[model samples]
Target: MMRKTLTSVWPLFFGLGIIGVCIGAQGSLLGIRAELEGFDIRVTGLLMSAYYVGFLLGSLRAPKILQRVGHIRAFAALTALASITILVHSLIIDPWTWGLMRLLTGFAVSAIYVVAESWLNQAANNRSRGQLLSIYMVTMLAGLSSGQFLLKLADPASFELFTLISVLISLAAIPILITATPMPSFEAARPVSIKALYHLAPTGLIGSFLINTCYAMVLGMGAVYASKLGMQVDEISLFMAVLVVGGMLLQWPLGKLSDRMDRRSVICAAAFAALLFALVSGQTGFAADNRHLLLALLFGGCCFPLLALYLALTNDELTSDQAVGASSTLLLVGGIGATLGPFMISLTMERWGAPGFFWCLAAMSALMAGHAFYRRLIDPLPAAGEPSSFQMQAPSPVGSGLMKSPPSEN
Candidate 1:
């Protein structure tokens, strides 16, 4: 019975894993490729941010496109488009050109997530929703981690690696395309009003943005930061891997703790921890001969979870439907922050040196933590038994303009 059950869900798990690999490769490869091609760090940051701009724009429009195209068609079309976009990177050298390609890739990939996640949600039964979601999460994490290691096998300086990733992305379509089982139809996108959500829960929304800003900055430039600090390409991969790995290790405990206590408190604590780590690690920079590996690990472990925790905490204040829409909106906001994070940090790094990148992150983290603390005093907490993790969070009136209707149920 157990074996049959496991086998039955293999396709969905595999599909989600592919999604993870696609994104992980995009994030890691873009950073490395930008540097090897001799683009300035700011350009690299701008290129990465271009993707987020695409993401934000896509999130708004993708639902309409998906509705007309249908799920499988939309997924296939976007995946193929993304593959082509990535492949173009191999042929092009100009920063603006690459940035445009990155934008298209981002828009397409964000739609892919909407389609894929909706499929996963549809396939799951009430009894198995949690299990399936957990499986999906793990697949995503592993696929992303695997993408990093793929860096080791390919030569980063050559176009072969980017082409190889494009191939992998193109191949990812096979399992979904060939599977005998039919996936779910896309949910019709809905309008998620920023004002309404703000009146509902403020802390989560703001925290969501802050956490996303941190994450976007890190993913966009952590490797570049490593390389500038004198680590080799392989070490850069390992550095990114360790940061993600630390987040993986802490996600469960931090989530559980948030469930039990004041989520605001949890977020504040996590941010403070991130601030401390970033201060130490960012200030010291990586030294000769991998002297700072431990600092990096500790820094990653401590700071990465702050995003997840803040997210989880934010969700704790939302309704189920609200949670879904709110999460997507928050994701869009985070994408914005992520897009800008690399560019801002890169400029700082160029002006003041490598440590400047981390100094920015530390300052951002501290500001967010302080904001959460202030909200705790000014706002009323959610009632007990609210679905914290899956509900859509509304920010206060002051920040209410950021909310939007849920993405259309295509």
Candidate 2:
């Protein structure tokens, strides 16, 4: 059964994986290059935030575009644009121009993800959907981790690296365009009211917001932090790679643990663990040695899974019919947090130093831990039958449109 399912979804996974490689490399490359070019940390933060701004816009608007052109054409167009956008970064040297490029890149990538995920979802039945999503998530994180090593291929100071990223983006278009798979019909998700979402599951709502904020900060500024700490480019890549690998490794165990008990307990415990790692990574002399990589591994393990936990908790409160709208609302909240996170964390780093990166992470995790404990005390868990099984969430908001009724236990 799993073999047949994997056969059917191979094209989607292949296309998404290539895109992930480009995304991972491009993110670290841009941050490092921005610092090399002497862009102020605050400006660098804005440049990073620009991606989320465009991503938020794309999440809202991409569906209409997908509806008009259909998935294949939309994917082709977006991938082409993404390729062009990366090359544009090499041509222009200004922060504002790079910010604009990042925005366009973000929009293109988000739309591409929506198209790919919609196709994957259409191909999946209820029996295989959960398994399919797990595979997709793993492929994504693996691609991301692999891409970081690509940084060693060329110096950030050169145009060759940018060209390589563009080449990868262009290649990502091929698997989808040449595949025998038929395009799926696109459906617009009804927007859920934020007020209603909050009322249904305040912890999930707020947790999604805060958790993604920390996520964006770490992803956007991590390279910059490492560069500022005097780590060489190779070491920086390894640092980012280790962090992603740790996240991928822990997803299943952490997810299964949450499924057995109150998810809020898991959420609080994870956040507290993240806080501890962040503090250790920030306050100690580990930042300069191999010990920092170990801390990053532990930090990623604790922090990366919170978003999935929160999403499961949110789905617990909503009826099946509300899942689609609720998913969009949760994604919007997350996008908002992501949009603001880079700037805030960047400001902190600018005022303090490299350790400020982990400091900001610690502060956010602390808030999440505190809120989870308070919510557990004040709010009651839903009945066993009410909660959705823990579903693996993609890093992008692409899967929201395909959200369905929770499956019954076997």
The candidate maximizing lDDT is 2
Query: How well is each residue in 1-410 modelled by candidate 2, as lDDT tens digits?
Result: 87886887787788789888888889999999999999999999999999988888788788889768777788889999999999989899998899999899888888877777777677788898888878888888888888888899998999999999899888878877887767777777787899988888899999999988987898888899989988888998999888888878888898999888899998899999999999999976345558999999999988988889999988888787888888888878898999998999999998889889999999999999999999998876543455677766645455455334322211
> By summed lDDT, which 10 consecutive residues of candidate 1 come out lowest?
391-400
> Residue 235 lDDT in model 2?
92
RMSD to truth, every model = 4.6, 3.2
Q: Which parts of model 2 are misplaced by more than 4 Å?
A: 285-289, 402-410
Question: Candidate 1: lDDT over CA atoms?
Answer: 0.68
Clashing pairs in 2: none
| TM-scores of all candidate predictions against the true structure | 0.88, 0.96
The deviation in Å at residue 44 for candidate 1 is 1.3
Candidate 1 stretches greater than 4 Å from native: 1-6, 288-291, 380-410
Q: Among all windows of ten consecutive residues in candidate 2, which has the lowest summed lDDT?
A: 401-410
